[model samples]
Every structure is written in C-alpha cells, then in structure tokens.
Target chain A: MKYLKNAATLTFDPDRCTGCRRCVEVCPHCVFEMHDGKARITDKDRCMECGACALNCEFGAISVGSGVGCAAAIIRSMITGGEPTCDCGAASSGAKTTDCC
Target chain B: MINLSSVKKKEDCCCTPQKNKNFLARTPEITGQAVKSLSNITRERPEWVTGILNTRSGLVPIVTTEWTRTDRIGQIRSRLGGYRMNYSVRPGLYAVGAPDSSSDVFISANYKLSFDILRRALRGISGWILVLDTRGINVWCAAGKGTFGTDELARRILGVNLAGLVSHRRIIVPQLGAAGVRASVIKKQTGFHVHFGPVDAKDIQAYIRAGYHATPEMREIGFTILRRLVLVPIELNQALRKSAAAALVILIIFGLQPSGILFKSAWTGGRPFLLFCLISIITGAAITPILLPFIPVRSFALKGWLAGAAAMAPLVTLTPLGGTSALLDAAALIFFPLMSSYLALQFTGSTTFTTISGVKKELRIWLPVYIAGLAISIVIIILYKLQSWRII
Candidate 1:
C-alpha cells in the first residue's frame, strides 16, 4: 500500500557512490536505482530513512535522517513541546536498527 | 523472564561458552523451550538424526515434530505476549515435516511469532526452516535493519552445513526481505540462488504450488483497521505510563489553588479539574485510536482535537464549574484539546495510515498551534489562581 512522504531526507551523491549496489540490496522501499555503474536515488520520497543503505554504504554516498516515524514519537514531541527526536518507547525493540542490530 | 536463572546455568552444545552471551540474549527461545519442550515427540527416523553424513561445517540441529505446524499453546501465548517483546525462537536450521535433499529451504527470522506465522501458513508442507539471527526482530523489520541481509544468510548457511543437507541450491525468502538481501551478492557469496516469495505467509503454499510465482494480491501489503487496532494496546500501555507523570503534575498544580478564610480547601472543587485531565488522556490515547478510520479530517492531530472537544461536550454544557472563573474554564477548554491532539499525533508513528509528508505537514501546522494554545492556557490558569489569591 502507498504510504506518507513528508520530507526528502534521503540524498545520493554520485561522486561518492562506489556502485556496489549495496543500497539497492538494503532498501526495502526501493528508493535507489542504479544507472551508469553508480547508485542513484530514483524515488526520493519513498525513503523511510531506515539508514540501512547509509550504514552499509562503503562510500558514504547515501544519507538519510532515519528515526522512529511512528505517531508516539510525534505525540511525545507535541505533548512535551520538545524538538523532534526518537522517543519510540518500548515497542521499538521489535524493529532492529543498524546501531546494534 | 521466569526461566532466565535456570536456563542460564544449563550448558549444552547449543549453549556453548563461546555463544553464552548470544544465547543469553536469545531470551525468548529459552522461555519457549522451557515452557514447551514436547516430551511426546515422535520422529520418522530421519537419516540426519544420528549424524550420518560427515561434514566439515558445524552441526545443524533439525526440529522434526511440531515443525509441520505451530503448537496451539505457543500460538495463544504469542498472540497474548508477542507485543510485549521477548518472544523468539533459537536461530538455526530446523527440518519441518521430514525435509530432505530436495525439499525447499525456507528462510525465516528468529522471532517466535514470525516463525510460528510461516509454519502455520505452511501447514502440511515439508521444508527446511533456515532461521536468521535477527535478535528477535521479524523478517520484514530485520531486512530493513540489514540483519536479514546477504552476509547473515551466507554465514548461517555455512554455520549450519545447509549445502550438505539440501541438494537444491535455491533459498526461498519472504518478499518483504528483498530490500536487504542482494540476490546477486547471495549467489556470489554462498553459491545459492535467492528466490523472494509472497509477501504474506498464507500465500506461501500457493506460490510454491504455482512454480514460485506470486499473484498480485500476494505481493501487496496493507494496513487495515483490524491491523491498526491490534497495535493499540502496546501504545496504550506506554501512554498510560507517560500520562501518569503528566497527571501527577496536573494534580500538584490544581491542588495548589488558594483557600479563603470561610471553609478551607486545597482545591476548590478539584474533581472537575482532575476529570478534565482524564478526558484529555483517554480521548487522545484510547478513543482517537479506536475511531481513527471513522474520524474525518486532513490530519490526525485535527481528528484528535475533534475527539477531545467531543469528550468535553457534556462537561462544557451540563457542568456549572466553568461559571466560577472564565480564565480557568477557557484554559481547560484549550488544554483538553491540546492533550488529545498531542496523543493523537503519537499514533502516526505506530500506524501505516500516515505518510512522511502527511506527518511533516501536520507537525508544521499543528505543533506551533498547540504550543501557543498551551502557553496561553498555562498563563491564563496561573493568572486565575493568582487573582483568587489576591496576588495581582
């Protein structure tokens, strides 16, 4: 099913991309497409900012501000009137992340 | 949680010292086996049981019984406790229904719920369950995290001696895992072909029967109301904790109200004030989530605002407390809706209903409004208390 896209958090710099196709392998959203032996972000809005591509990318070609995009985080920010940051609570352990996954 | 101490002391081939930390980390598996290691298991005398074929690769334990389908008790336990986390299987290769040289090797995450899900879906089917060490995370999510990636598959294959067990070189993984598993890289590293199957486990039999071809419906994933609703309890649990803290803060503030010389009171009719806080929290955390689909609005924050106002409707009209101080009443009106809106905003993170853009848009427009309203309400409430105290 189609989902929401709020910001273009994902950016691809061809200069740094090694064209290893690792990003293509890691992105569940299919945000990246390979062209001319280099990785390119075809669907900018589709990036969930999971950071798999950025984490696995050897060349630092891919960058995305990945965080918990669930309502709880947003609600926490709104309630506390705090800056946007991941306050995912306990439910987050179900989903693994590159930091220690 | 019950068997951590008992299981911690027990050491076997699976619980080797080298793998102690990792084993301890797989708490769900320990609990599962502790709770349900079937003593009535009967095997079909599979050749691999006695270590018939000698291979250089490490030993791969095969689960024969209870592999064909999920145990009903475990299914019930998972349904009840899966959201609480700490539910997973031991990450390894398992033989389901007497899998052999030609049986399809199925890849699964270590999460017990995910394992049970596919096993139940594949009910009378025989296959080799090649589970990845996803640290109790599900396949789709682990794939996103790259735990279900090519390297893990290749490593697991080597560790389990999968090549020796099965003649077929193809591994069938869920379609959702396509993101992290580079099919080409898997082939290069493990000499095995990766075939992504249907998105849902229920479609596995059909996909395999139809020569590994997935129908359009099988490929599409959806977030229906039922699915969204199931996630509410965990969110509610977390919200209750946070709201309790908020409630205490509210109680302290309201209880600080001045008492005149006539009849002493910490709060001059504080029940209504406390009720307002309850309405705000319940509307945001519970009501908004239940009636999410029916509520019509551009953004979830607005929908919450509407629900919060509706909750306060009777209090606004029927109750005579607002007549005492207009400032306190106005502050209550603004604060209740803001609380609901903020709570509603949190649901976006847990649901598939919202997109990144929808959220960014909502936050941009509503966050500022809520902040301003909250600030003004706090000021008005403080002023009302000050006037009652004859301070200003």
Candidate 2:
C-alpha cells in the first residue's frame, strides 16, 4: 500500500520535541502522527517540504533538509546569486541544503 | 459642488461666510439636541444620498432608504426624467466646520466605504479631501486595477478645481494605492506633492496626529486570523455551487445507468457515494480554511487530501458497504480526497497565508499527485461499471 518512497528528510529528536504538536498541527501533508505523546514523522513520503512546522516550533527537536517546496523561489534565488534547491531544471540539490522543517 | 446660485448667498464659493455668519464663531447656544444627536444626524445622513438632489445620471436608477421621510420612488417621479442620482456616497467627513486656506489636502477613492472609513478617521478635524472617481471601488482594489492611478487623480483634482479651493500644494494618499499611482506624474500635472499615508484607514488618525509620518510597520501587510477568515465566505460560496453541482451530476449518472448496480445494491450503495461527495466538498471548502494554519502538512493540496482521507474513515470503518467493496471502494476513497484537496489548494489566490512562490512550489509537487489520484479513482469507477454490466 506504499504510494511514495519515504525520503525521511526530517529528523525528530523526541527528547527535545517538548510534546508540542505544532509540528503535528501545521504539516499540510499529515506527515506527523502522535506516538506516545510525542510527534513522529509517520508519513514522510507525503511531505512536500514546506518548513512551516520548523519555523513555528519552539523546541529544537524537529528539523528538515532546508528546501522550500517552491520551484519559483529556487529559480529566482538561482538567478540572483543564491543556489536553487527547488526541483527546477538547473537546481543544485546539494548546495542549498539546510536543517529546516 | 456648491451651487451658491440657489442658496441664500450669490457670493463666490471661495469667499468665507461673513464673520457673523460663521457657524463656528457663535456656538454658545446649545439646543435641546445634545452634541451626540447632531453627530448622529451627520452620521445617519449620507453625502451620496443627500447629493442626489443635485446630480442624477440616467445609467442607474435611484433606490430610496426607509429612513427617507417620503418614498424615494415618489421623489424620483417629481424630478425631470433626464436627471439621475447615483446614491453611492457614505458619511464621516472630517469637519468641525469648513476648512480655511491653510488646510492640507488629502485624496481618496470615491467609493462609499473608502470615503466613510477615511472621513471617520478625520473626525473633528478640518481638511480638504480630493476624492478621485474610481467608479465606486476601494483604494486598494481600484489601485490594483489602475483606476485610482495618476491619470484619474490628476483629472479629478483639475475637474474639481482644487487649486482654487486650497492654498496648500500637497495631497496625501494611502500607500496601498502606490502600486498603480505614479506620484511623479501626479505632481507634474497638479503641482501638488504626493505623500503616501498608512495602509489602514484606522491608522489615519495617528498618521495625521504624527504630522503624516508613516512607520515601517504601518506599510507591512500581515495575514492575521481575522483577515484570513473574512475572505472565507466568498471561497465557500464558490466551492458549494461548483462542487455540489459536480456531486449531483455524478449521483444522477450513477442512478440512471443499468450498469450502475451499486445504486440498488445494499452492500455498496448510492448512499456511500453521496457521503463521499459531501466529505469532498466540506473538506475542500469549509474545513480547509479554518484548519489551514493548524493542519500538519507542507502542501495545501496535501492538507486537503489528508482531511478528505480522515473524512473517508467513517465510510470504511463504520459502514457495511466497506465489507463488500473493500478493495474497490478503498481505491475510490483514496482518490476522492485528493480531488477535494487539489480544489482546496487552488484557493491560495484568495488566502493571504502563502506567498506566490510558496504556492507555486506547493502546486509543482502536489498537482501531479492530484492528477494521479483522480486518474486512479476514475479507473476504479470504470471497473465498477464493468462488474455491474457483467463485462468482467
């Protein structure tokens, strides 16, 4: 029944997760499910990698590879001196990686 | 437009009333009505409706308010047929009395709501308002469409004879109008300098009190919860009409076909299909906006898809139909949520939460999945048709 490969871009440090379901509440893809009162990335494959959860999280437990799922932002960044991480034609997937969720 | 021709004085409109005739000069006599009563009277009577006696166009007919002492329809019959009044003005002009030559001039759109909001901000102050005719639209929307641009502002200022009315050579404008208005062009035409004010009307009082200085925060646009919620109504209305019609069509198609035995079958019947459509509609429209900030997901389409998925749970877990069409119905269930999710994602244009680049990013990854989900559901439906028709 697996529809997508789990890239596991996010790493959850449960010790630091603070039981804050901000990660659980804000992910549009339903990537996180609650496990034993902690937020877990149960459906990582559903992640389109919008970093709202990480941006809003108070605890340093949740982290995702820094990449905005926005193709246009990556393209604009590429043209303006920054490396593109979005899945665009000329994006450097490795260059702009960050620990963002 | 002051028509002194019909008034008690035939003197120039610019001439200050005789010092004795000055309404503000001798104001010791307090009548039975309180100041609140007078203020209420001013607020209750709209400028646009009151101005109807002067300017009536033939393009639109006038509708009177219940507050009008006489039926407005009767009032229209008494006037010459050629004159038409468009009652589009609102109240709340800034005036303790008429402004003198020293008052600074400000510009605004002619839309009633915009005028009211701006004027209310200027309460108890005396200033000149140079309203541009944007054909009854707010400054932001009108500016976006270029109706409140340089040309209109220049033309309206000249048409209204602003130079003759005011001594000051500066006109303040809302900052949001800068998207379409070129201040340089307006300055060249009218000789009046353009100063951009705060984005919100409520901030105008503070802006005026601070000598028209705008802080950085005043110009920034934030999509607060209240602001996002206001836009939900139009989105829901659009979704209800389109999605409901789509559901009804699908239901009617299922009901009419002889091959659609699921319509009559108790195990996997039309009821579940109806429920599917309801879940899809609610998940996409009503639930998505309210829960958007809270929904755990990276993509809007995915969030909606997840909501749809949750909505499908009761059908699969609680209903007997899931037992008969376990696999087939499950296939249908998977795609149904995706359809709703994709439609909900398109609502980004109406919401202020996501940036254009962010939404584009969301769509790029999510649209393909949405299409694939839809394709899978259609295939399941076709297979169901085949089974009912005894073809497979």
The list of candidate 1 runs beyond 4 A from truth reads A1-67, A71-101, B1-83, B257-268, B318-324, B356-358
Residue range with the least summed lDDT across 10 consecutive positions in model 1 chain B: B48-57
- Model 2 residue B297 CA deviation (Å) reads 4.2
What is the clash tally of candidate 1? 13
**Per-residue alpha-carbon lDDT of model 2 for A12-97, expressed as tens digits?**
78788777565554454455667888888776555534454554456777766534333334435646867433321111222432
Write candidate 2's Cα lDDT for B1-392 as tens digits.
Answer: 33222322312111222232344323434222223333343345443233111111100111121233333442333122111122134311222124556776667776644665666566566566666766555575456446677788888777655665567787787866664476667778888877777777778778777886755566544556676565555556555656667666566546655644345453235566666776777777667767777777756777788888887777776777465565457665776788678656755544423433455556668767766876777788778766766788
Give the alpha carbon lDDT tens digit for every residue of B169-258 in model 1: 999988777646767767888888877788788899999999987655675555666776666665565556666777666656666754
Residue A35's lDDT within candidate 1 is: 93
DockQ for candidate 1, please give it: 0.19
TM-score of each: 0.69, 0.58
Docking class of 1: incorrect
| Model 2: per-residue Cα lDDT at residue A75 | 38
